[model samples]
Target: MRPTVTPCEDFNAEEDAKALKKAFKGFGTDEDAVIEIITKRSNEQRREIATVYKTMYGKDLVKDLRSELRGHFEDVIVALMLEPVEFQAKELHRAVSGLGTDELSIVEILGVHDNDEVVAISNAYEGLYQTSLESDIKGDTSGTLKRLLVGLSTGRRDESCDVNEEAAVKDAQALLQAGELLFAGTEESVFNSVLCQRARCQLRLIFDAYNNLVGHPIEKAIKNEFSGTVKDALLQLIECVRDRTSYLATRLHDSMAGIGTDDRTLIRIVVSRSEKDLEDIKEVYYEKYGKSLAERIADEEEVPSDVKKVLMQLLL
Candidate 1:
């Protein structure tokens, strides 16, 4: 079944502020209630609250929290109150601007997201900070990694304009021919034509044909044929067709179940997906790895326990 788009719930920021201020005033701290409502609220509601809180309380909601709370507890609370794109842009900007590139953070964030969201993040980053995210990536990263990040940031890497069965057939044929000849030129042409030019449904069918003829997943073939941005884009298309949740669940399990945890991937996945489908991901994680998502996360001690506990709560 296809996922249905529902309109976001309407929330009055001023109304919520009155309630929140009252709740905060009465108790020592309504930490439990704060977590409950904030985590459950839609991104639209969070944005509304951010504006309303400022007008109602004369302080940024996030700033107020920094003064009121500390540690992992504070991080999750503040995170729940920001717009998703702004949050993502902040994460991306943080990932690269430091001494070393947070390549894993960049990969996990951009890799799991659909192209449209990526473009929104790009636009939001510029609007919020008056700096081009693409330029920051160019300045901060180098080599194949730089190419991959910039290509992703451009938001065109996954735009499929129109579906032509005739075109898909031709593109699939070209891919077969390229694999037959071991010609690098034909490989790129095949990728561009099928992955870039074809519509989503058309490309899905094209990939089916490609796999039937080659007896291997297109992902494996592209991994062998391409490098850098080209490779990332092709693999992204394959994963997009495959179940995204399972792909991410598998990623999370692998990142943590390894010799050492991939803290960035683990944190970003939990932070971003909890509201959308963390429960579904938990089920997928269990089925794929024969262990619950929570268990794997619990096993990874390198991350602070408070952080891990809050992550688990968000999914619940």
Candidate 2:
């Protein structure tokens, strides 16, 4: 995956900090100066700048940015400032903490992350909140969703890239029996065991085998057999495993679509993917939506110019 932010050649954390301090000084904030410095620098550089800013100025960089910036712009800056795992942990906490669960956020975060990424987020969540990520997920969700999230939070998915053709066939047959062949309903544990535990490469092969066995895509089978949050979560996992970039592209489109922008979702995707796959996401977004992400953001009157500028920089 191509990253939008590569390290600057002459990166100096103290210089960047001083530049930022100058931006925030005097009668009015130099928003452009702030944007140029924060958005162009890589996340590692930003973290270093934050450290230097604290050491030199004795002020928290985030607090200073918060005091100067407002609304979605602040959201962009703050998200950019956080370590990736920490940001993901905070987003997951926010998703599960409110009155009703943000199931999509929960699914997106948990389903898309690989075992190591999940482990990092789980550890970060615990470190940040003084509680287990799994416990929060368990309390916030119920039924199959709770089961799936709790299981996924363990980060125990088989990470081997090797595929076993025989095992794939058996898993495929097992899915058919557990879902379509059952008289009452699908077997939840069967679905969990195969979907949650298999290596992603193995899961791909199994999905192909499943299509051949069932005479339809595994997704179609999943749709026919399951419903509600469980169905959504499972399908998201399949989609994420199959093509993570497309999955994220779809997410970015969803965040910006209709009514008003889901700022949290927008910020999360932009911030998290900026240093990982935002470049590929931008490509997929254009191919899928027939308009560049930057163009789409440029057209949105609701997004403030400062926030849009920062987002566009990340897209670049």
Candidate 3:
């Protein structure tokens, strides 16, 4: 899947910096200019323009955006300006730091990203927050969820492409013994160990083997066995492996399905996926929801007008 936002062929960081300065210079901000310039360039180019803006005019681009823009529009622009890992880490930090823990955000982020990307996210999390992501998860969560997240935070998943059928069968048995084969006292450790360590390809084989052993899909078995957030987390991990595009499309739907939209979740998914598989996500969203993602955004009256346009631009 290709990114929606490619590197602009006629990109000029300095000129962009100047244009942005002009937009923010006097009176009311030129909202149209701000949206056009920010959304037109790739994130990397935006970073370059930020650098040139600071060097040329001694003003921070993000700070200026914050000063000029208000509400969700500012949030969208500020999110766009951040490095992807930084933005993700910031989201993770926000998810855990507040009074109420957002368990799904933590699960979704840790589950979806690959090993190297998770490692970078964890490192950035540590750098930004002065604490390990594992420590935070441990402090914020308990029992199975804690163990699962701590395992993921280590970023030690075996990423080898090869699938070992013998091992997969063994893992399948372990999973069955953990939950499906047992009526009481399900083994969370077994679930954690197998799901956290195996490569995605190996996990797929393990899933197939589990289905063979259990005479039903692994997701159904999980639903019968586990409950609550842990269950959702496990199922979501499987979903990510099965079809990440659809997983994200579902996340987008989750963010928007309810009353008074989940702006943070919506923003994070849209901004994060803008440059990676967003096209596929949009296609999946339409295929799944019976309406285009752009249409959904447009219809969300809760979304500010400027922010809606910017999101639609990313879909382009």
Candidate 4:
């Protein structure tokens, strides 16, 4: 229940604005001052600071920061500055807009958000790009993955915590029959249909019931039955339904696991979750991996020193 970043005590908009102006005034940027103000305040507070900064001085804070900062640190700060929903919208747009597509980015955003957040992201996407996110996704993706992204964009899933045990039982059977019980190939539609509409709470019960029905875990069956991006998304949804914190921790790990760091992915997760559940994510990260999330990031040679320092400011 603890978010790493909280609203600062004795916050003053003009004072913060003045401090930021001073940070940007000298020969060199006061990165520590920038990081301190940006990381300590909540997103709402940050927005207020930006507004006051603009009102006090005719200069735009983001533009000034842009002029002063460079590289991944700038990316993180700017991303942090946007409204969360808007940031998500831009991330989705980025995921689809460029050559090829970052299918996993779509999954990361769409899979994690609930009905309202999803709708908000969709609206923000259109507002920012003056185009529909659904169309962009359709253009970029195909097959079941396309369907999944489009489905998630609707924000129609039941967002309640209410559980229906009987329905859960039937859904469990439907999954078993669709996957493991039938030797005749899996019915992927059944998965897509059920996953698209079921409430997260209901999905959890369905998963539990499925486990009880099948001797093994539902994840194993999913791995056996599905393939490609859809399979990864499904597994992530299941993971989210099971333990969101652990899922996010794995995401943090996966971002840094390979040859080079996924700076955008890393920044998005840390920044988005920083004020929400980074604390819980950190706990899960430590419990899953031997080292803490900060320790993991700190060890990554790819992350620049300033980037790592700013990241640690958020983490600790």
Q: Write out the backbone clash pairs for model 1.
A: none
For each candidate in turn, the TM-score is 0.75, 0.96, 0.97, 0.96
Ranking by TM-score: 3, 2, 4, 1
On lDDT, the stronger of 1 and 4 is 4
RMSD value for candidate 4: 1.4
Error of 3 at 278 (Å): 0.8
Off by over 4 Å in 1: 1-33, 100-108, 111-115, 141-149, 157-165, 176-180, 183-197, 226-237
| lDDT for each candidate structure | 0.68, 0.88, 0.89, 0.88
- Could you give the candidate ranking by lDDT, starting with the highest? 3, 4, 2, 1
Report the Cα lDDT for residue 247, model 3: 91
How well does candidate 3 match the true structure in TM-score terms? Answer: 0.97
Give the residue spans of candidate 2 off by over 4 A. Answer: none
Question: What digit string (tens of lDDT, one per residue) describes model 1 on residues 1-316?
Answer: 1111122376566776666666576446666656655655666776687788888779787776666666656766677667778889888888877697776567657756667898898888888778999898889887555666666566565455555666656767788777555645444544554454344567677777777777876777777766665466456546655567777877787677657766656766677776677777888889988888777777778767666666767666
Q: In candidate 2, how many Å is residue 14 off? A: 1.5
Per-residue lDDT for 102-194 in model 3, tens only? 888887898789999999999999999899899999999999989988998888999999889999999899888888668787888998898
Q: Cα deviation of 14 in candidate 4 (Å)?
A: 0.8
| Residue 115 displacement (Å), model 4 | 1.3
* Candidate 4, superposed: residue stretches over 4 Å from native: none
